[model samples]
Target chain A: MKVRHSRILRTAGDMLLPLLLLFSLFLLLRGHDLPGGGFIAGLVASAALALYIFSRDMRSARQVLGTDPRSLLGVGLIIAILSGVPGLLAGDAFLTSEWYTVPLPGGREFTLGTPIIFDIGVYLVVIGAVMTIVLSLAEAEERPWKR
Target chain B: MSLAVILPILIPLSAGALSLALWRSHLAQRLLGVFGTGALLLAALWLLQRVWLDGIQVMYMGNWPAPFGIVLVADLLGAIMVLLAAITAFAVALYSLATLGAEHERFGYYPLLHMLLAGVCGAFLTGDIFNLYVWFEVMLVASFALLILGGERAQMEGAIKYVTLNLISSALFLSAIGLLYGLTGTLNMADLALKLQDTGEAEGLVTTIGLMFMIAFGIKAAAFPLFFWLPASYHTPPVAVSALFAGLLTKVGVYALFRVFTLIFTQDTAFTHELLLWLAAFTMLSGVLGAAAQFEFRRILSFHIVSQIGYMLLGLALYTPLALVGGVFYLMHHIIVKANLFLISGLVYRLRGSFQLKELGGLYRERPGLALLFLIPALSLAGLPPLSGFFAKFILVRAGLEAERYGVVAVALLVSLLTLYSMVKIWNEVFWKAAPEQGAAAVAPTNNALLYAPAIVLAALTVAIGIGAEPVYRLAEQAAAQLLDPQAYIAAVLGEAS
Candidate 1:
């Protein structure tokens, strides 16, 4: 679909981008304990980016991304692999989840672990892979000969 | 020890990611390509040694127990296949340095190749059936990308067919996994083998699921009736890519067949294995006959891949220790020889500038070394003596006789003769005949070590396997014994809980 520029959409997309990204982060953080996870959160974030592309132009959307989607993929995968290494270092199998307890205010405790890091990695990978495909397909559509 | 189990998968995967991260640097990507595959070869060698000395190696992902979490198991067969994949990947990575266009390299060839290697290794190492399906998709995606990397018209056409058929196969595989899980409540293969043994009332459902896996894996293996996609697409890629696919891809499918039939689907050998036997015979006959008609260098080699797959399945079909040994031996032998053949075909294209036998001639007169390199694989592929293929065929044929499967044995010999005919045709057209009079001034052969080194090493490996067949045969024999008796595998995966 050729999305013609609409001022209202452009304005709304600019306003909604931050909200959507925050919500995605919420989903990623809640992934280990709840139904939300890296995959869904990444999809939601990419969907927000797709909206931004439809309202603005490809150049602006890419400017906002600020780096190649391919690099995001590489970084995400490396992060994921690194997260798995702690398991190996702990004398366990690869990808074994290790937990750490943090002291919170009022004598409370918060649990943290490698799974979150792994989830963040997956989050980046999903977004990067999806955007790479979508951006390329959009660019392909923009060719003058394609018309 | 558990860490060692995953190194083969992890190394290539990280290398792929690293190569992608260094996208702007060609020097880095090239270095990553060689170093990554070389590291994988070393890791595979170490894993094979560990598995040989220590027996089956099993590691549960995330420290989950067997039947509940994903498990990586490196039996001897799995280790052997991993080593073969590393061998092929390393060789092709070297070959690609010479032949791959700069455009393709810039467009992420090395990264994709490494990912493909990771996928192949994962498929070899994973012990869970669902995980196996995931690995297959990993392979399919990377291969599909590699196949159409250049985005040529013919490649697009080939990729469509390849993807469509393979996607169907994957669907079948997933559905079968679903049905098997529904019936038995487990996706762990070792656990499934145990659960399946007790599913007395659900025998028919189990067998149905088994057939589903067979058809699914059969398409991937390029078995009879579902093999059209292989020849349609295998030749469209660059020669290094083709060599990699020829050596590794379909063999993974064959490895899956060996794993499933020998481990999980052994309950009704009369029904399932019997079907495999007939299908294997037909796969052999049809693939050889198909090669007899093709004159294109890669196309001919592609068909031979299908035919060779038949011999492997025949070993599985006969379902005896010796036959399984032969099958394992053939897997090693064929990966080396077939890949070398495709690599040699690339060298031929470089020298003569065509894949069509009709357009090519007189390589023997100009570059006799190339002729000799081609002959080693071509003759061995036809199952000529004192080469790896000869020993492989000898064992399989003997196994067929001992099992009293005379009809398939006869077909096997007949197909061997026909394979020789096709090889001779290539020899005559590409090497023996006078260069078509137009290019009377022979093209000066470019001396590129990257091109010939891989083929020479692989050819030497083939000869070594033949001359030192005893040790290799013993390895296969032990792998076959492990395959025949699932107790060790089960114990290794499930620990004392089983």
Candidate 2:
């Protein structure tokens, strides 16, 4: 027999969502200069997504994802590969990073580079790969709902 | 500036990524498989030509300096191996297009094939030891998935054994790399060559690490006492996949052994090489005897693979200029013939509806064309005169005689005879015997030109390489010279070797 979880635990998992998501975003953006980056952020975000799925159903979880994990996998991989194109264009070796300085509204300089794009691509790939695994395992089981 | 060196990896990689993103479209994936492998073949050929002309083509990823960054280096041996691997991939890709059905396509067969190619290309091109390990893992992952794609019980069983054993090998490889890095403080092969030679201390530690590497690559190469995983699993997959594995997978291990022993771990030749010599003797004897006992079509071929690896290892064990050339030549020869044999076996299965030797019959009467095709590779595989294997075994035996290792040379010749006996057995049972009373299963796509195309093409290649040995011999000589003398390779990568 399947042991269903209590309503309170489901509610708590749902209520904890915003804070977990914001922390994951923070981890993603702060990764360039600090200890965090795309990989860790992806794991955290995937954890949050898994929690939501645990509290709800796979169909709703699919709706929340907005796209299949496989498409995300392809997109991430292409982005990572394409990010190297700029390096190739600059007559450098493949995957060589180039930096640019952008002016913010406060007259401060912000740095941008292909590494950021690469990191984001890595992030998406990790999430997509993990989600693909988790969802496949999850969806292999049969659950009942009204037709 | 050899950007061409990187294309072999990039072509398959991009194809896999593209195929992954377009998972819903079977047509797109199939086209990607075809175009990607075709482009890869062209790129590999270009890379081989570039290496032939320029000597050693080296490309540092992201322009990082050597000894610090990962470099893709294609010398004569590396370039030729990559070219042959691409050749096999192209043929097997064609075979898969016809063999892997709609269900397999839905399961991402095309992407996985490209992924395996990427790992193989990376393994060939990498100039770093640690990076070689990474490529091995990449191959392991893709191949494991491909091994059990249909989730058949036998496939799962075979895959379990393959994965478990390969994982242990990976752990040993990783630990050996870690120990070597700690000893020499470098991961680059050229730099390691210099550092390993120059170090006065840690002689015993170096030998121990060398043995560790041998064990790791030994398992991959399926050498004696560690070759069980190969015969246990190779026949379990589809024939196209098996052909791909037979053509390139074990050869990668043999290549690694040749590379590492020739370049990095030549510290104590007497002890290390003597050990390899005995291993080669046992490997050949057991492999051939195993083949003799097996009644299944692919299983016998699988056992023969182990036996053939022993020949390549014998060349390496001899450790002379002629012997190394023989090893390299044997690698090129065996890959083409073995893959063709496996592919032909698939056609036989399609016609006869079984892989059992007892059930398969009358192919010579039914389809003489297929019999003729089989005869070429089979004769060549058994070391007949004027074929590629004859030249390969001849050079190896001559090298052994020159080196005065008569015992192993005698064993090698004996194994060659046994190999012939097994080939005759297959011929008599599968092609010449009367059809069983139960009758054979009818085949699909009756014309099936696609099925015969690769086998015929590969059979022709075997004949061409046999008839025209001078140019291929020259390539093998150049490759062996580079392997025998590590200074040029080191200088090419690390700027004159200090």
Candidate 3:
């Protein structure tokens, strides 16, 4: 019953998830100083997962994505909240971003801040929240419930 | 110093995260929910004490100064409100432990509840209007998830109505904020106030935008013509969920209404406050009258919440110092009393195995002790003498008379009598009425003290606030005075680093 050309899209879907995941990580890491941030990265990751799920059945899809989205969401919240604690400890208000810089082998340098950590936390949460809804919708094959 | 305010919010949020991480473990959630809210309560009390000893406290976020950055401001009103929120959350958390069956717990209930608490605290403390919108959404999203968690048909139906209406309110709120920011060009409340004085000629435009806020917060507050969602959705949830929603959710709307109107939108009082007064009268009449026609247990209480909110709005609508104090006092008194009443309804459901009044009876012959617990809040809610509601109503009525707002005062008194009548109806049907001959099928009495403790604490609080009204009154008066003149708040927020 399936179309002959569908195999190409199915393979593409499988290939796309990893690439998308890698890009999501890139986005999350570079989010503080650039156009990419945790939320956008999470959305991209979720889009990749959604595509993968659409190309496969629910059980197999769940198997591929082994971790629970709800747990990811919780961990994300924990990280985000804890990221604020450093500011509190430094005797400023909660969530005041602190920073770090790493000297590269060349003359250039890399700098980071708590806001990035917070953004990563946001990234995890958005991915977790969106994927939870998507996977649950994917499971609802009959629209309300599935056998 | 900000730790006092920050911890009240952070403790719950972090606890939510930890518990959500351990979502599979019921034992972990139970321990975390109770202990976490306990920490929040203590922290809130400290925040209140600190604000009490000193004066208004403000903390800028990200080290940003007042005008440009978001700030958390804790005047007496915000401090007391945060304290109340923590207390209610703590009580409800304990109640949830005993009352939420495993299914509800497994459905991420604890995490959402904690998130809801964090949102409410954020709303109370935030000094920026736009930030308030974010907090409201945080609360809305958490509550929306909690509402539809079970995926029950009725829950979804109710949740859909709840979600749709709240979304509209939020959109209106956001647009109002957009227009406000466009108009004032500042997001912070103190800065907005400073800028709004120059909006002298734009009074009409200010009133228009202010009405947008009124309608938005009014929907959330469940005022007249906008409250249908509350009754439709509230009774459909499990009793524990309903209790939490009943206790905290709508009140947040009322709180926002009071906060924005008192702080930023005070330029055209005659028109805006006049509209509020009329809405307050209608909300009270309609809410109580709606309760009269409802035979279900939770539905009746649900309608009464609308009625009670009218009282709070009346306090704001009057806009006098004593009336404002009356409003603040009523806010404290009513939150404890209303929340306790809902918790008691959950207990009644446990005892009787049904929420329908027609199927229930005969508790008086057996559960006399439960009767006392019920009466404390019920009578207090009815404004019986020496209970918190009486003093709350008394101060409000006296203030109304002093202001010579005779018409609304008459409506308030008439509504009080009707409120008493409705409470008695619930009392007669559920507690005093004899069991029907064949349908005397009640569940075995639950000896679970955890189930009873939250209601007991709240009922005791109602009695305490009633018997010892002086200290509470003084606090409300102080809060009202500060609310009247935001000079101290402005100084604390905009004052040079001290």
Candidate 4:
């Protein structure tokens, strides 16, 4: 009975984390127009992940993330830079945003492009870097004689 | 040929990544350390020649052309900063060889150090604002790792405050970039300069963004009210890491403020300049007072770093070519001298286990050579005559007077005297007084040649710059002129920004 209860709790947390992350990403993508942003959304996603780690364990969380957080941060930054590069390639200056459209299978589709990609990059950067820092600090604190 | 411009940044970055991948191998790490710094130093010298001959070397990455591509430009100022960074990184790498133990040596120190060097060099050389933010994060992340490498209690505590404060500053910097991008639709600094020049009626928005950038850089530079994180955190790391950070990181922030203000935001000078002047004065006084209050040797040096930053800001606030030149010259001198002093602190710790002034004394008798080495930079830091510090301050004060800012001149002079007093206090406490009875025996009488080598090299460089001030001063003057003119910089980066 106890094992079942623990498994249920774990499964619920697992479901909840991705939901929170997706919600945060939604907020970030819509940020420049509204009240959300890369920074705040990143913080929210990282916080949710932190909660997941607290409920589960760091090693398990690392497995889910599939890489070192620092590497993730580096990649996020590179992506952010690359997102800005399209603007430059289009003969605008650095960080000058360009918009475009794409078609979906169902019908004619319109979607915002470069700026959202940039925002996603920012979201990943802040989320990955902040989580790396917070998790490192937490683990350091958890050492046996840290007190 | 102008690709000499990008090589300084590229060499260190590629080397840093390679070091990280090969971190487990001692040979690979050391080879990266040597080759990375050596290549950077050579590139700096080569670029200096290019700047001397061709005026300024500009490289647009990926062959995308100006304003559109990420540009790296090497003016005299950028070249000098690159050189200084290379010199200091070289010295610190040497010191680390002796100071960092097996655990630390094995734990990615060289990679982080090289990465930091790359970040600093990138910050110095980049011609765009967003790139500056990226480099700031690069340096900050590397510094965070270096800070907490040993995981001591103090180090962890300091890291927490340092990271939190820096994270907030990076956020502010990013928001400022976002706002600037939203307003002007550009992040190329050269392009922004032209756009901002034509942005006459939007002066309010320009001022707002200017102030935001100032505050952001101010927090990073630790200029006055934002300086609390410095003293709270600087002394926590091992001496070699602290030395590198004290020498390089905050100066990168100061360099950014100098660059942006001189280039893109000169339109809002009245607000930014006056605000800077008062902050400079307050930062000077308060930093010295903090130094006065410190009983630990490294803590005192840390506080003085804050104080010296105030001096640099004074040059910026004065806003004349000569004054800015003085700030640049002072920055160069301070990087070498400050790093040397911190290395000396490491030497002192090697001889005597503690860094508290009360526990250290009469090093004149035991290690007079080290005492002499320490004294030159210490005296230079106090702005004594016939030293690089004095020349730096002389130009600054002269510039202040030329601008008819007598109050600033008075404050700067008084700060110099107070700086001398603090230096003397450290000198007397650490080297002049009788050695403590227990310390006398506990302190080994052995010579640490490996540790002393870097300090000696830096001291020699300090004296060389002091005695050979003509060429260096002229270089600074030219750099200052280029900064004030902004035409060549903009032309190089944005094809005249029409």
lDDT of 4 by residue, B144-244 (tens): 98998887999888889899989999999999999999999988888889889977688899899899899999999999898888888889888889999
Evaluate all candidate structures by whole-model CA lDDT and list the values in order: 0.92, 0.89, 0.87, 0.84
DockQ of candidate 1 relative to the true structure? 0.76
What lDDT does model 2 reach?
A: 0.89
Candidate 3 Cα deviation (angstroms), residue B28: 1.1
Question: Taking the candidates in order, what DockQ does each have?
Answer: 0.76, 0.68, 0.73, 0.07
Backbone Cα, N, C clashes tallied per candidate: 0, 1, 0, 0
For residue B403, what is the lDDT in candidate 1?
Answer: 99
Best by DockQ: 1
Q: Give each model a TM-score.
A: 0.97, 0.96, 0.96, 0.81
Q: Compared with the true structure, what per-residue lDDT tens digits does model 3 show for residues B1-498?
A: 477767777888899899878978989998888998899889899989999988887888877888888888888988898889888888998888877878888778888888899899889888899999999999999989888766778888898999999999999999999998888888998888777765768988988999999999999999987999999898887667777788778888888888888887898899999999999999999999999999998899999999999999999999999999999999999889888888888888888877888878888887888888999999999999999999999999999999999999999999999999999999998899997566534554568889888989999999999999999999999999899886677778898543
DockQ score for model 4, please? 0.07
Error of 4 at B81 (Å): 0.6
**Which has the greatest TM-score?**
1
Model 2 chain A worst lDDT window (10 residues) = A138-147
lDDT of 1 by residue, B1-498 (tens): 466789999999999999877878888999999999999999999999999999999888988878899999999999999999999999999999888878898678998999999999999999999999999998999999999877777888999999999999999999999988888889999999988877788888888999999999999999999999999999998889999999999999999999999999988999999999999999999999999999999999999999999999999999998899999999999999999999998888888778888889988998899899999888888999889899999999999999999999999999999999999999999999998866423243578888799999999999899889999999999999999989888889987334
| lDDT at residue B272 of model 3 (Cα atoms) | 96
Stretches off by above 4 angstroms in model 4 are: A1-147, B440-446, B496-498
Give residue B378's lDDT in candidate 2 (0 to 100). 91
